[model samples]
Target: MKTAMLEREGFAALVLRLRAEGISDLDLLTAVEQTPRSRFVAPHLAEHAYSSRTIPIECGAFMEGADLAVRLIERLRVKPGHRVLEVGTGSGFMTAVLGRLSERVVSIERYRTLVTDAQARLDSFGLRNVILRHGDGAGGLPGEGTFDRIIVTAAFPAMPRAFTEQLVHNGVLLAPIMIDEDRCIMVRLTRTGSRFEREDLFEVPYLPLTPRVAAFL
Candidate 1:
């Protein structure tokens, strides 16, 4: 069994590496340190959970890398008392992070198994600020009302109208825009009242987010 001291040291080392890579968000770094990535992945793959590599779960979609997740969360500019809409709940690692940073998080997932497992993990961590759902994220959660921040974890072929329309004024959206069959670019769009300004942040490869619900066996 890995001792708590060893776990703390490991997390410390990972934070140091992230800091070296120019990640200067103290709150984000602190959240990463507090949340154990091992809790989100299987035991055999726990050793690689903190690394900047995508970890596959039971669902067909893969979890975002630690580096990418940090970058996106930093760009999200989460603040206390802010309601966030997270489009992919995957392993709930990011959801847990969002729970720490925002007032509340509404996360939607297409796969029932991922939702169930991620919900259990989030609940086990005592993060009651998050609401997990099994649904098509492209539709957004209209019943939950507008969000102060929106994050999409997978690549979408076209800009989602629901996401843009559901954003509160001055809200920000960080998502991967699918440019082609194999290419995607990360974009940060901010809604300013009736208009939205788009900025291309970086390039990333992500699993395509579909509108159809998954048929979990």
Candidate 2:
């Protein structure tokens, strides 16, 4: 009982920090608060579930910090009716949050282990709106039809043309673009007619987006 209380208190403190960082959307905050982040991470790393830093997960992937994930989702401007495509569903933590914010979420992960684990966690939460698949997310899922929003968790050398083409009119795509060997900037691209209006949001630290799905692991 004492441990549970401490966990709750820690999470509450994390929520406070997020609010201070300008995450004022009531619904977004509620989703983040309600989702059990600890369940999405490895048992040994549960204590750092609410921390504002990345945690290593299965298949050698890292889950983005809670603060960064929420900020990027905020920039996407997810709506209750929006269909979101999430590339790199590391822990399915963000997938669950996106499920709460949007109508439907199709999340793809490169590693089969990550996909299986994430699907189980999402299912436990009864998030039926999310679909988890094991595939290369480098080029967004174009065959799934157009989406209202697309968020890439990994950093790419350039804006992926396939992702931009998979967005519906006026749809938003948020991704980290590598400006150089060590510099990465998060960019928001909005589809307008036949062109995309790009807005550089902020710098971020993310692993490079790789091609092809993992055959082993």
Candidate 3:
């Protein structure tokens, strides 16, 4: 009983901090509050789940910090009826949040173990709107049909043409692009007829988006 209270307190504190950081969307806050982040992280990292810090997960992947994740989602402008395509599922924490905010979420992860583990967590939380796939995220999911919104968690040297082509008309795609050897910045590309309008967000430190599926581990 005491532990549950502590968890609730931690969530409330986290939400307050996020609010102070400029996250004013009530729906987004509620979704984050409702999702138990501890379940998506390793047992040893449970104490750090509510903090706005990146928690390491299986396959040597790092989950985005809560503050940054929420910020990115806010910029993505997810709507209740929107279908979102999330590349790089990582720990699936963002996938679960996206599932709550959108009509459906299709997330792709390069590592099979991450996909399997994330699926179990989503299932345990009764999140049926998220579909986890084990495959390469470089090309995005072309065959899954066009999505209303697409978000890539990893950094790429440049926006992949395949990803832009996978967006529906006026669809938005947010991804981090490497500016140089040591710097990366998030870019938002919105499909406008035959072209995509680009907007640069803030700099981020995300791992590079690798191609092809992981053959092992």
Candidate 4:
């Protein structure tokens, strides 16, 4: 399907869903619509391109739709010149949405197969700002200077210190952090001086951040 169809087939409604959740930025909305989710999806699952929910891709991983991702991305306050780092690159859908809105995006996926597939799909679209890496996402992130926005899709028992370190002072890191075994909140952390301000935004259930988390701290 052409990208135009995405606009006609409920993309606006999806953007509205994000907006209703406090995502009101025009650039983010445009990126969500302009990025072709289907291109990142496995061919077998292309039929669900417009669904406003998570869809399974390779391995048991799922891509959270535009509604949830845009809402989360909006709160991170990504601007046209911001550099963003994402810990999970499922289907590369969010990365693409982000790629449209930022100066540069570095996405890391623990699953190598997903990483390669997402890289290929992103290449097809000429979305050059998205850079993919295969690694242990829970181990936090390596410094490539600092980012204005850091996003993590998988839930972690706690926020990774490396993530905070990789942020430019006052930058935002959005991640699902656990309060308990079965309870987690997608938090927005703003780096302020030497500490981070934690703001719990919403409840979310996700596969936990990897065991490699301890390796970093």
Q: What is the TM-score of each candidate against the true structure?
A: 0.94, 0.95, 0.95, 0.88
**Across residues 1-217, which tens digit of lDDT does each residue of candidate 3 receive?**
6546656877887778877877789999888877877777776777777777888888998887777888898899999999999999988888998999999999999999999999998998899999988898898997779999999988999888999988989899999999998889999999989888999999987978888999897
> In candidate 4, what are the lDDT values of residues 1-217, reduced to their tens digit?
4555654676766766666776677777777667766676666665566666677877778887656666777777888898999998888878888888889999988787888888888888799888898777775567578899999988878777878888888899999988888888899999888988999898875778764322221
Model 3 pairs whose backbones collide: none
> Which candidate number would show the highest lDDT if scored against the true structure?
2
Q: Per-residue lDDT for 68-141 in model 2, tens only?
A: 87888889999999999999998899999999999999999899999999999988889999999899888899
RMSD of each: 1.6, 1.3, 1.4, 3.6
Error of 1 at 217 (Å): 4.5
Of 2 and 3, the candidate ahead on lDDT is: 2
Cα deviation of 27, candidate 1, in Å: 1.8
In angstroms, how far off is 80's CA in candidate 2? 0.6
Poorly placed runs, candidate 3 (over 4 Å): none
CA lDDT of each candidate? 0.85, 0.88, 0.88, 0.78
Summing lDDT over every window of 10 consecutive residues in candidate 4, give the lowest-scoring window.
208-217
Candidate 1 lDDT, 1-217, residue by residue in tens: 5845545766777778777878878888888877888888887877777777888888667777777787789899999999999998888999999999999999998899999999899878899999998888877888778999999988888777888988999999888889889999988999998999999988886768777678762
Please give the distance, in angstroms, between residue 47's alpha carbon in candidate 2 and its true position after superposition.
Answer: 1.7
CA shift at 119, candidate 2, in angstroms?
0.7
Residue 87 miss distance in model 1 (angstroms):
0.7
